[model samples]
Target: MGAVDRYLQEQHIDRYAFLPFSACRILQPHKLRNCGEVKTVLLLLTPYYDGDAADRNLSLYAVPRDYHLFFRELFAGLREAFALDHPGASFHAFADSSPIDEVDAAAKAGLGLFGDNRMLIEERYGPFVFIGEVLTDADIPCESGEVRECEHCGRCACSHEVCLSSLTQKKGELSGEEKAALRNHPLVWGCDDCLLACPHAKNVEKTPIPFFKTDKQYRLTHEMLENMDEEAFSSRAYSWRKRETVLRNLSLHGE
Candidate 1:
């Protein structure tokens, strides 16, 4: 284990991988300079609280308080630590909205199993994990770990065409076929058919992060949305789309 690994362990973060910063694929050319001075990328698997067995409509990812906020809070300490150690080194922390392709980067770093549902599934946390990164100028070597592939059992229950998540997040009115699908779909925000159907979702451990464990919230009601302020909206994963987008999906199902 290296200093980077020690940092992860000290932070109680067990699921992490390191790769060269140059290996990142989705970052735009202009933004590449943000990481140009960085030699190593630290990929982190941060877990959120999936709700209890309530058959709730919200996606598992949204069960916790805004993860982007939580991740920034979580990684802030690491950034400071790295800066102290490297003296003038730069570090940036990103959750979902960063330009980097987190999933592909995690796969390249041999972090977890790639599922047909297009999620990264780790042994302890399953696939219900958020991928984040800390790009730094430190010369941390990539973890010499094995990357796992999905079983390819062809058991995936959802497709891009019928994926409720994609259709709901899409701007403008829903297509006729999409509206028809929404009418029967169980969740108002995200689709979990593929997640629930995966054998990997079974028998996973609860998240150790205090933010996820102590501050779990499952449902997202119309009342909640009506009361949500800008700060609240800007924190969660679904905030990229406007409030109207969520309301449109909710109204389609009469929720």
Candidate 2:
């Protein structure tokens, strides 16, 4: 095992893969400013599902605090360790705001199969894991794998325009038809309709990470939204749209 693998194991992060930069599809080259000549991509999977996430007004992923914050702290430590190991090597970490197509990279690395819903589905964590990566100039050994596809159950397929999760984050006023769709939508932040219909997502193991297990807000009520300040809103996954978006969703649902 390499230093990176040892560090990940110590951190209890078991799902990870190493691939050559040539295999990755760089979507945002502008994001890689100082990271010169990336030679390797280290893809990681951080599972957040804790089990039985029912009766939540937010998506299972959003029930916990914003994962971006978690990744920031995690990557800081990782980068520091890498810097110490290989002097002059550049290491950059990214989560949702990634330079490469993370899902595609993860699939190519053999971390999981591409689900029909366009999510990476690990056998244990299913599609509930967050994809993060560490891009480096160090020449790491690449894993031998290929892009694999899921069973394609065809249950989670839906148009992007009509997706309740997408509509909730959409800015400005919604159309009458869109309003009707969200009237009885379970979550005010993100939709789990697709995950709920996925067979592979059934009875998955709970996350061992304590950060996700504690300080969770499964149900964000109208009262909570009304009382939320900037600090509280910014700390959550659904905070990107601000409190107004959630409040509007709740009101439309007559909650």
Candidate 3:
């Protein structure tokens, strides 16, 4: 089947878009242009917003399974399929660990552009989606999709003066003032308030079905983290520091 059918069946994706990227060419030189070369770009889309399911705790992204783990496995499965078809071909799936610039590559492939909010925007999924791509030697297909721009959005300046990503990764312990930032940080692992403030995202369909239809609400509760020991807490999401770190952040956030 083609990339379209593959995305639909394999991914169980009701909604998706494919954008071909020239990441290999960007990385390689002028000489080895086509010498036994094979490569294709694959983009996967996942929705992570749950409406009205409020905990008022934990960052938006870390509420679910580790995306790095999920993306790595999914990309590996894709490469395995490629190897089966091409036999002697060599292939590998690059998670975020790759040196290639992912957001830039995706935008070049016609996925979308990075808005002033510093997030990729598409007509359907907006900015709440995680992007993963596969690099290979087998030549795949490409298409010209919509070019969505984010220049006019003033929310980034008016709001989100501080980035949530930087907030959580804020080194060691926190003081009175630093803890306040964590509470109003918008998210723990990542932030989407800029997207949430988008007028475009407001009118789009409400995450369709199973995307929002899950009892499998990925969330990290205070109680869940409170009981965990140093090792156990570290095993889960948002446990980036000693137990004191989360407690301090939480205490400040709750206040």
Best by TM-score: 2
Going through the candidates in the order shown, the clash numbers are: 0, 0, 6
For candidate 2, the clash count comes to: 0
lDDT of 3 by residue, 33-129 (tens): 4334435666655555545346545554555444565565566666666566656555545555553555656665666666766566766766666
Q: Write the per-residue lDDT of candidate 2 for residues 1-255, one digit (tens) a residue.
A: 656666777767899988888888889989988778899888999999986555778889998899998898888878877777677887888899888999999999999998888899998988999999988898877864788998876888874457788888987788898888788677788888788789988888888887788889888888888788888889999888877787888888776
- Could you tell me which 10 consecutive residues in candidate 1 have the lowest summed lDDT? 140-149
TM-score of each: 0.86, 0.94, 0.73
Q: How far is each candidate from the true structure, as Cα RMSD in Å?
A: 2.7, 1.7, 4.8
Off by over 4 Å in 1: 1-11, 22-27, 143-146, 157-160
Between prediction 1 and prediction 2, which has the larger TM-score? 2
Tell me which residue pairs clash in candidate 2: none
In model 3, which runs have C-alpha deviations exceeding 4 angstroms? 14-39, 141-148, 158-161, 185-189, 203-221, 228-236, 240-244
TM-score of 3: 0.73
Model 1: per-residue lDDT, tens digit, 1-255? 555566777766898777887677765556655666778887889877444657577777776777777777778777766666667777877887776777778877887887877788777777888898887777865643444688987777565566678877888987788888877777777777787777888888888777776555566667788789998777766777889988887787676
Q: What CA RMSD would candidate 3 show?
A: 4.8
Q: Which of 1 and 2 is ahead in lDDT?
A: 2
Best by lDDT: 2
TM-score winner between candidates 2 and 3: 2
